[model samples]
Target: MSRRARWLAGACASTVAVGLLVTGGALATPPQEDSDRSARTEVAVGAYLHYGSPGVERMRELSRWLGGTELRAGHTYLPGDTWSNIEGAPDSLRSWARWRKAKADRLFVLNVPMLEHNEAGVPDGRVAELIGSGAEGEYDHHFRRLAERLVALGVPDTVIVLGWEMNGFNYTHRCRPDPENWQRYWRRIVAAMRSVEGQRFRFDFAPNRGGDAIAWTRCYPGDDVVDIIGMDSYDQPPGSTFREQVTQPYGLQHQVDFAKAHHKLISYPEWGLFRNGDNPDYMRRMLVWIAEHKPLYHSITDYCPHGVWQCTKNPRSARVFRELLSAK
Candidate 1:
């Protein structure tokens, strides 16, 4: 099954107005302090280091190659094994965070599961039912537990990318079929997580780069509930040029404009070569664009077939990456 299909079959289950609202807490800023920079558009670079080799050694290696701490943000996923309440920080996650913290400050982009599974066999109606009834309190319980666990693990202020890519049709959390309930459920999760004492988590309202499924704006939960606006953009669609990718409706530029208008920080939690692999220009263009726009953080997914570290699929892109990062 395809990635989206797997997410759909495992279990079917599962953001914002613009500005005028402040983030939930004052502590919801980037972990590092760059005094010369402004909050609205400060750029902190990082990547998904554990994609290929799952450990701190890989991260350290990447950082050494990049000529700085590998990254400020480390992205990972919470698999759809079970939708039960989290009792404490998972040992692996705790270990990873601890390892990541040793080298540099970490901003974890945790892609959590909204459903029990994302298998193709699951019916939309069943998934809709879960969303409609607030997932039978599972949503609140899960987030509350997650928040508590994070606080206990010493990783407070995590930018929770809750129900990310919901506007995209492929995921189980797609918002089109029942956007109203999706938005409400998001609000509930935010409230529940925030209710956890000492849990200073920021919520990132992220979507794919285009209207491939539904118009992302239609699913906006509201500015008050979201702390950042993120995008998971990849070099897909084969023939489209980089300029077109950013200028297209619901593309990177749209995401940036939306975030700027709302006074929220921007984050590219996931971005890398896809259909157009080894395109050095894409790497150069992306780096320049990121530097110009200055989002809070951006992460390049470094995994086999799509990574710049372990996988040698894109040598030119890797060269550009090293040059740019090393110069910084």
Candidate 2:
């Protein structure tokens, strides 16, 4: 079968492919001008940080370290300690925005509270209810509020990957097989964000490529609705070669194939080095992959270090971390 044919078949919905071919190109931006006045696109490297404690201090250092190099952007959780409603969520977000504005040109969010608040593992009743209620507008409204705040805080259009890796089975709705619900929620959010920001914000539909061609095909939110085809994968130490660990399930080209097929950009938003086997050498190998393929728009490692005030403490990972920040 033809590629498009296969895509359509796997999606099990023709509207998805049709929506992809039309309507802003598969969760696409509203045709922003890629003029020279705008900054050229480049990959970023940063880490995920929760607000409070050492996050504030470590973020300061991370930004400082990356500022001296070619690092393009940073990714952080939303409501970054500046904006707060109840627990000061909005306040936190605004704070992070201010912090980011001073250093990085762009920032990406992996998940948002709107989705997290209602997240139930795959087949969650709430997910079913959202889909069942057919209230795409309600779901979209929540995301729009978040996006609006991001814009209000001065985050540019080219940063921000809303709901990254929502398709993976690990998070809420572990592989929620209903493409329509996912598509509806996704498109509604994208549409709401665009209505506010226009083409100023870039969006990403991230998923874990587990060699489940069906997984990619099954949950694809149509082609036109996505701006970037992203994957999150990693190779822990002590098991296989770094090359084998990182590349086996989904290699760089696999990502490229998905991007080419969908006409989206590429990125590996969340990845890291776990304690699998070879120790420091494995970390070096992972860095080699980043250097060699340059596959990510900007990369982030899992750097929380499992305790308060403990970031940048993983010595094995820190070596690669310093090297990546230093690489211009």
Candidate 3:
């Protein structure tokens, strides 16, 4: 894998006292090119609060700390150890649905891993076989169950980040094993999920930044099946400049252009400090980039190495993140 330090951080516990601190205070705003704020994209701002119910409380605490900057997006992942877990467990679904139902505008992002034992380091031959099975609809019922469960739980309009970072070789659902079969499986899963009644889910096709195992485009299911084009970008490719990150092949710029051409919105499902430790410049640049591009919803994976808030190692970057995002 060309990408590094993109691991999902363990459960986080934020000790930052609510409503008391604003590290750098408000950022100086530039003169508005147009005063019609209504027409502007007040993008849904959020962070990966946690993988469980404590995330809800963490969101509350984070909001207060940011002077009530609306943390409208809540992100989490289904445990991929088993097909049953992928079908949506009651303990987590109930809590997240409760949170989503509390506010009609809150965006719920759920990362759905397409394979069981998703991170077991399965070999390519076995992965290829599994992808072939999935492409032939062997696993359609699992996603259908998940969709029905989400609908029944009252979160019918959740954004489903299916097979996230598929362009990378990090998971069993990866697209590298057989790109053809991978896309077929993606479309099949989407079809199964959509067939469920009372479901309104937006599927996000997110890839890790940079050209990894394969060109992300080769794995694209299609424009019709995908609603949001996203990237799990972190400050990486050690010693690379932010400019290089944007202009590099299959990097941020390419993703934006690709989404625009497909007439779809974009998002950063996962982003934050990486490779470059405590680098505030990368943090500042990423914030500016998000504000400029205006994603549908972008969530910084808020845990050590990638997170600025919960993680203690990157206070400088944390200050930059807090100051920039808080002002918006």
The global Cα lDDT (0 to 1) of model 3 is 0.81
Q: Is candidate 2 or candidate 3 better by lDDT?
A: 3
Report the poorest 10 consecutive residues by lDDT, candidate 2: 2-11
What are the per-residue Cα lDDT tens digits for candidate 1 across 22-124?
A: 2221112223223223322246666766622254456677878866544666676666556652333346677656754565455766766565564333556
Q: For residues 119-181, could you state the per-residue lDDT of candidate 2 as single tens digits?
A: 334356655565433325755555566666667767645455555555554444233645566
**CA lDDT of each prediction against the hidden true structure:** 0.68, 0.48, 0.81
What's model 1's TM-score?
0.82
TM per candidate: 0.82, 0.68, 0.89
Model 2 has an lDDT value of 0.48
Stretches of model 3 off by over 4 angstroms after superposition: 1-29, 33-41
Against the true structure, whose TM-score is highest? 3
Ranking, lDDT, top scorer first: 3, 1, 2
Sorting all predicted structures by TM-score, with the top scorer first, yields: 3, 1, 2
In model 1, where do residues sit more than 4 Å from their true spots? 1-41, 51-53, 85-89, 100-105, 119-121, 135-138
